[model samples]
Target: MPTIVRASVALLALGLVVAPDALALSKRDQAAVEALNQQMQAAEARYRDAMVKIANADPAGNADVDGALEDMEDVMAACAKQKGCSPTTMLTAYKRLLKQNADAAAGEETPDDGADDGASLAADVPEAARAAALLSADGQRFVKMVQYNPAVQAGIRRWLTDMRGPLIDTYENYQYMRQLMWPQFERAGLPEALLFGVMAKESNGKVHATSRAGAAGPLQFMYATGRRFGIGPDATGFDTRYDPRSSAQAAAEYFNERLGQLNQSIELSLAAYNGGEGRAQRVYNSTGGRNFWDESVYNQFPAETRDYVPMVIAAAWLFLHPKEYGLTFPKVDAKPALLRLSRPSSIYELTICMGNGGTRDGYMRALRNLNPRYQAESWLPAGTTLSATTRMVGLYNRWCLQGQRAELASTLVRSNASSAIVRTGPVTPLPAEDAEIEGGGVGAAGAVTTSPSVSKAKSKPAKPTSYTVQRGETLTAIARKFQCDTGDLAKANKLKAPRFAIRPGQKLKLTGCEG
Candidate 1:
């Protein structure tokens, strides 16, 4: 009875669309409105059941979602034309359904067993910040609508061909951090494949990858943007943008908001992700929300974004159907485990002691990725716990807990290059070519003598006029290393203020730096 009363009120409120006298339905029209409402209710129930199946990864879920959504849409359209039915009432019911789904999804996001504390990142995520089920009607529609044009096909080609190695690497890396990262997206009802696609394209799954524009983390959130989404520097001076879990959560929140604005268009939302949201919104508005693939809409975006949307889609598609393209992603044993350090050790030291354990490279990358707060070289105290895999924990116990290999690893890491070289007498110059030879013998004084350039001129080697940026190096770090004024160094390289953004291997003028 309350539902009927609400429908009557909606019809009365929507009188602007019809004559006020026509607000009251005749007996036959009343029957039609009630029938439409029943159809909508049945569709909503089916959608809820399908969402549960989807969360559990059931194949039948997709078909159920499609059918339910079609039913709802059909009812809504019929309601719009029905004399006594109100489209506004139908729209309100649809919104209520989405809100219910969102709330349910958010409630189901309990902390994983491996979480360090009860107040885990998943637990901390606000309900409103999470999205409705990706397998729900709207999300399924977006998935069904994604186009595989030539641009996307080209992206697939690149991923399967030249970028194949990177794609494989991304999958491997994502596996190790999947527990920490994927849950964030999952809780938001985002597709896991989309997360991988973005991570693959953005950073090759490198957690600390920072772009020239100062975007950081696996999701590559720019600093300002990261701040808006509750991801910034913590009190410990660690930027959460470099954190896989937090960054993934922030990225999900970003896409959730963008998709809401872009009428659930994945291409447009992705374009917003890469290009500025303001630019994406303007284009959407000017085109009256046309399809993103439309020439008029597609051409308006920058070259980078135009490439980015399809590439992401292609990567996601490959993620969904890797075997279809004859690509087999390596299987990884990613069961979460914790490693409590038996003694103080660096990640580099752990890597040496951990050995290959059947992996091509050791656990160095995994260690860095899982425990992003600490650098590879930064020593952790004894009993310090680290997020690790079962395999890594097993390796640590076998090889790293105060055994011969553990001692050897510790010695190797502690052995300094400077300490290895001993000077006992005045340096004697040698031929440049000879100086470059490896393993030159110690001098008569039982110390290694300088092989090159005891340059008698001693005019201080000419200050380098230019420098190539190195990985993980920031402008401030470079300034400190080169003893240059930060402002002057930025100006010399024409870098912008605040961010002083620079990418690895970017060339910069060393004009303001000293020898």
Candidate 2:
């Protein structure tokens, strides 16, 4: 079988202990090799960054990509030419130096840098990323035993007390979306507990969660990382990074890709996922392909990562055996179904009508999870069929059709500023004589009149000549939003009729129509 080399998260842990061949290098040769190694690292970083930039672009364009590629070519050529400087050797050296730099720079206790690691705190790591399965093995037992460790015990205590609400929220949210997200892991032969652990830690199963560094979705994928794994804006302008199924697939593929290259340690795969893949691989390789839990390997990554691995393990264990920790996961009725709207309504309206009747907490999150493509307040046209839960269908039948609750929902949703922000004063009555219309016009009586200029101006405002597709926008929705003909908008953008696909950052012209 062919090895899968991923765009990101490759080339870190060679997983082989470097033993010198019969030909050993002198001190001078070693120094020269180190110098060349640094050069190779610089070139690789530059190339990787450029590729990431291009991947995140609308049409995969990057001006610096060519230059970076050329530099990599030169570096690789240099490596192949030099007797002591192979690509693997160079990368190993880079990893060693990187760890040295990180260790030197990181204080005994550095503040959590959530930007790179995608998580925070060793204190919370135990419970953040956790999962469990029916596996019975020494490794599984070790993972379970980790929950009783002092560090993990702190996390469990926090979960049972201070962090209880957030933990419950994540669990509930995960259950609703598990059907859509878990299959990817199962198909990939990855653990479901791991998925829950990462989901809980990353975005707490919130599909719309966005980080300051532009990571989004249930798994919180950064744009560049997501693009590498087929997660990006769709033709309808919905970012696939925020889609549960797609993001889960991407995350699974990414983990597998790292697994193929690294020491095959889940901790290392996660390290690459949190800290860069190349960095994780390098650390693994530098240490002769040893365990990630080793003091040398553990301290090499950021403090955040050190905590992340253990925490994820703990979370996974708890997910598997919540009862052991005196925690009970709430039962959810999440059987899938399609809900065809009998009347035009938004998720907000539907949620209001559904009430808190069936479930303890309402169906807002359940509704959102089942239909991730649509926003909560987006109005769906009547008869629009959406992915939903059977419970939702039951709730809809009972409350949202045309009863007092339905009427109240519609009224509440439709109550606009115009009606609510009423005129405080009494209504102004028109003059007995007809009011004169402005714009240099005379009427038969005191009636309002319009000039040719005013008449021309009174026509509906001219539509914008162009539009840039924003995230979550669709051709049909955009046409409706601007009151333009859908066909014209599609044609203007040279889009096909039935399925007019558009991507975010794409521009479209207003052709042969007015809004």
Candidate 3:
């Protein structure tokens, strides 16, 4: 009622345009607009219910109720006038009202009605103390919204396409690893679903994934955390986190420890994983030791952690019901099988070894897609046998028959010759062990012993440079500055704009520009 009319008028002005020159909308467009308007009406009804609840609960806050109602009217007016505003916009407005009401209620002191103390926080509490009281309720609601949000579901669909077979293969690998680690999860009484969520978030199911944070494997367990759970680097230079089976076990154990300390709440355990256990513990203690969704808990952590629980729940929901959510998961021609290579090889080397048969290019793409943690483009390194489907194995066998391993090894030697020579220097010849490990045991055709010094002398390379674009600078201007065409610049940087309207701090590639 308060300022609702003024807000509605303003929104209508911004959203609707009735002009003589305006083109008539098609029947389909009109129908779509009507649908959006109906969604707005539904959203408004829900918002009004929330406002009524707020007014009834807080006797002294007619002002908050008035503001909420006004905002709702404005949002509805905007939707009606535009006829193109999505359900997302309407829903967002409703949620904003609910959040504001919740925040206000959390800040005041009110008598409890013998409801679960974990359901909400006491009013009149300080900002820091309020999060613990409200986090549980907020967390539950957040998870629900994420599970149902159509836009979020659409995003997951896009991600599935980009990830395709590699993610599926990795998920299958996770099942195998989970089997070996189930005992640990069972012993800890931790939810099995938590592992899947963690794996998806950390590495998109890639067993060999590593993070910049030094968290390794599917769970992204750091060295300290891994050590705490009895998983770490071994004598063979294998970090247990890189091994699917070992990492799964360690993740289960670590999660159990957090759950034990945090009242068996998965939300709190997750917060500890993203932020830190000590911070979570401090927050829990500050919020009267309630569950993670207590309003008091939200007030304690950073914004990233506030959103993390919802994201995790969203991912879990998608994984459980990909088809229901309209996600087109990749179809596998056949179930993937793990192959143990007798010799160590890099992913690059393995690609060459698996040569041009039965979709070898597809196999390499899948390997890169699955193992994003591998920074190097090629070579899986020696002693590391990779898991791939039958198709990949057939390709690898074909490449082996062609006798191209030596050729590939020669290319690698030539490529890395400069770095190898520079690092080893003249007096200290390349170590035999290092050579064998890096060279992947060069073939009998002088592949292994190709002189690094000789190769370095023959290869010629150019240096890289940077370029800056000024105000009103076109792609043509920037390209000309670097002595290259506009098309080359666009291609190199993947610019989609017809003409470059470069903004400050926008980097343009000039590394390969010709004079």
Instruction: Please name the candidate that would achieve the greatest lDDT relative to the true structure.
Output: 1
* Candidate 1 TM-score, true structure as reference: 0.61
My TM-score estimates for the predictions, one after another, are 0.61, 0.57, 0.43
RMSD in order of candidates: 18.7, 19.5, 24.5
What does candidate 1's lDDT look like per residue over 335-354, in tens digits? 99999987777788899999
Which has the better TM-score: candidate 2, or candidate 3?
2
**lDDT per residue, candidate 3, 326-401, as tens digits?**
7654444444565555443445656656654433234554554344334333223234556566666666565643
Cand. 3 Cα-lDDT:
0.53
Which regions in candidate 3 have their CA more than 4 angstroms from the true location? Answer: 1-192, 207-209, 333-345, 353-361, 364-391, 403-515
lDDT of 3 at 68: 50
lDDT of each: 0.75, 0.66, 0.53
RMSD of 1: 18.7
